[model samples]
Target: MLNPPIPLNEMDRLLSLSDLDLDYAAHQDSFKDLTKLAAKVAGTEMSLVNLIDSYTQWTISTHNLELEQMPREDSVCQYVLMGDGSFEVEDLSADERFKDKFYVTGGPELRYYYGIPLNVNEHNIGALCVVDKTKAKELNPEKIELLKIIAGEIVNRLKYIKVIEELKSNLSEAKQTQKKVAHDIRGPLSGIIGLAQLISAQGEDNQMDEILEFMSLIHKSGRSILDLADEILSADNKKDKKTPELKGNEFNLLVFKDKLDKLYTPQALNKQIKFTVNTSLASETIPFSKNKLLQIAGNLISNAIKFTPVGGHVIVDLNLITIDEVQHVLQMRVTDSGVGLDEKGIATILGGTASSTNGTGGENGYGFGLVLVKHLIDSLKGTLNITSIPGAGATFEVNLPQ
Candidate 1:
């Protein structure tokens, strides 16, 4: 069998090097401890922790290259620039892998080199490369294993930096978005509410009907403002909840069916949509968070009210399915008659992406509602399932352990 040649372009890309990467590439720029660690592992006097950018290599940890960054073309660790498993040159001057690679042999009497790529993702920033002045030494399995482990430690630190970068970006965006949405909605909402109050105080007349219409508009606008505020607040308070104390538990969906009815009543009234809350499960409750149950129900019902066309219907139901002869699961569904979604929309909501779409009254949000739904289900150690056709409404099923 012939071997397939790796594309040179893709092969050279190594560890994750974000604009926020803190790794200094110069051997002189690295801390003394790291330089010492590198030197010790390579049994060399010039071990270096190198990070390569497009034009130059930075020395992060090094024993010999103190205070000076080598050029990209002259970097022996440039081989580490590849995200491939690892690069080792037993004798930099003799090995075919890098013998003609002038950077490895031309500088510092370097006769040997070995490097491990520090890839955090597709971003290949650089390598933990080592060099020596003596004859190439054979490294056994144990020695190679230890080198890889040290490389992992370096990568772990890099990953923490990367995550902090991502979180900061997400946080900033969340706050700004909440601010703009809140500001835009608040002015009109307050005006409508104030005017409604003034009309209610007017002297009574056949104007009662006109006043009532104003009152209804005010109420709907007020609800919209409230919902917007809730969403904004929720984003700002992204839950940093300590892991909940987990224990054996159960939630009763059958008995909870009636409670679901009470909750969906307002939604039905507002949308003019008929909703049925029914149960088929023998065991209404499953082992899960009692409070999370309410949150799930509230979100689903609220969403139905927002999307279901006027005069359409929504049904909430639960059923028991035997997983095995001895085990059963409580299944609950919230089905609504409304604008149906395409396959991509379903995937976004179901595949852990926040998909937003405009609601019945031109209320805009991600078409994806199942993000929260899926998260809540996971928190309860349960499962979520969804099915929808483009024209038919969506059905969401929450399966809980009994």
Candidate 2:
């Protein structure tokens, strides 16, 4: 005979609780102990906790039995879900409903059976059952009550597992977010420190105008750092918050170049590497987030300088390209003659694997810089392309709508 059909309403609830599709068999020790306790309390030789889905019956916990699963059509627990409470079969071989069943006639020769439905969120999903080969008397009232209580405990344990899994997932996400924030902030903070030190060592003969300009740049870098920190904190607190409005400031190309020059010139000079910048943009001002743009540019340029040999060259090119005779796009390209990336390295880095290595100058790198740059470009709705040849160089091209 075919198995009894599950009610549509209960099936819907079972589908909704998909997160409870756990492999309880992998954690057999605790569940085996529960099954043992259950068998002793109910005075049964064989007891098991079985989770019944639409297609199969999975035995999560079992005592005095080696059975693990069976087809739902052959499951004895199917009858248990048909009622509001515990179900019992005093003699399966004599019962007309199961006398011809394979489990009764050929498998386990099951005769006496008793089961309590395991319900979760009003859905009858499984059962805690006990079976025996020999015909046994009907369960006493006290044994039936004990089986019901054990079933409730099993349901509670499943709920607890679900909660613990969610907490672990959240904690993993929090750690990744923290790592990203730290990686992004490091570039700008280094720039601020370097620029401040340059301003301090200029001595008494330093020109007043140059001193003021340096100080202004320092202030801007400090504010940018604070803004980044605030944004990260806000994201953590309000996960469902809508994306904030883009804060656009008038970005001057000359000022942008000056900042890059201050940040990378010393490093390039110390390595005796040639550094060059070429621009073809006619516009002086653009509306964009200065700090975010700086981070993208600074990170790429720093990586170029760090990896380039003493005689190698690093180049930055900027241009404004008109698209479809209407929209204008800013194209920035950074090319470096350094220890380039092979296909595997490029895939690992772009895939956010967080791989790290030392540069040519023995300068350490966290390997998260390119990952952060890619994330920033995505936020700006920009496109980035990478071209590289091992032992030759790598080129990064970025295009953003104006």
Candidate 3:
């Protein structure tokens, strides 16, 4: 026999629901009680909660039935799903559609079949059914109504399971976010505390000019820590409230360059690493989110400084390139002469596996920075490419539409 045709929209909805993947047969105890109640209420000897897939009809819960699954072609529930109301066959042997079916003509000789479709997510994917061996009389109005009520209960349980699963997934993601925040702030906080201690040790014994310089370094380190905290808190708040659409704001390239220089030049000098920034559009202003851009650039530069060995170099280049001769793309590239990544390390970092590694300067990192950078780039509708050769260097290129 041919398979029954399913409506396109119904099929789409069935595929989207998480309940379809649930192995209801494995946890059949609750449903087994439901089937028993259904049978007792409807005055039937056998009851089943049947789920129909592409080619099989699975009995998730059954009372007085031996089989767990049968071919979908032999299923009465398939016909039940064709209607919004219950399907009732008072005498299966007298019905033309089921008379020749093996279950009717062969063993058990089912004579009565009644099924109410179970609707979930506005789609009927299964049925609550009752069957009997002896010819049975037509169901009364009260019994039919009770069957429908039980089917509705099954649908509610499916929805409840879906909600619980979603909550669990969200909680897991939130915990990971907290871990990432702690990881990203560690290096900057260490710098702040270390610089503050240096300023305290130099009290009164240092020359006035030297004292002023050390105090400036301490202030800069403290601001870096604050900026990192602010970025994390802002991201969490947006997520908690459901992220709103971002709007473009005026971005000054020269101001951005100055911030980058102030932020990393001292750290580079301390480590004896060459740090340079080259921008072709220094005086130009662009429409972009300045804070988001700063977050991405800051994380990249910080990671580069941490990984690059002494005597190595880190370079940042910003320019505009024409694409298809009709649009300009803003290109920002960060290149570093660091201990470059192997394939395994690259996969672990970019895939958000939270792998931690010690940097060239013994700086500890949890690998969340690159994951955040990738997410930010995607939100901007941009592309990021990383090129690396082990023991040589690594380069990260980002392109955003302008």
TM of each candidate vs. truth:
0.36, 0.50, 0.46
Q: Write the per-residue lDDT of candidate 3 for residues 208-258, one digit (tens) a residue.
A: 677667777877777777677777767767764752222223244555567
| Candidate RMSDs in order | 23.9, 23.8, 23.6
Model 1 regions lying over 4 Å from their true place: 1-37, 40-46, 53-55, 60-68, 79-112, 119-125, 132-140, 153-163, 196-402
Position 243, candidate 2: lDDT: 31
Best by TM-score: 2
Candidate ordering by lDDT (highest first): 3, 2, 1
Candidates in order have lDDT scores of 0.61, 0.70, 0.71
Q: Estimate candidate 2's alpha-carbon lDDT, on a 0 to 1 scale.
A: 0.70
| lDDT per residue as tens, model 2, 257-370 | 665665566657867899887766564343333436655776688778777888999998877676754477777899999999898987765664545566786654445457
1-402: candidate 1 lDDT, tens digit per residue? 111122244212321242333423212332456656766765766666666543345666666654345434445666665546777777777765456544554555568777887665655567777777776767677777777777777777666655665676567566668667886787777787777767765624546877677687777778688678768756545641432222222245544665566545754774577888886545444333333565566557667656778888888877777787657766678888878777787677667685555567544343323455666677667887778876678887888765
Best-fitting candidate, measured by lDDT? 3
Taking all chains together, the TM-score of candidate 3 against the true structure is: 0.46
- In order of listing, the candidates' clash counts read 33, 0, 0
Model 1 — which ten-residue stretch has the worst lDDT? Answer: 1-10
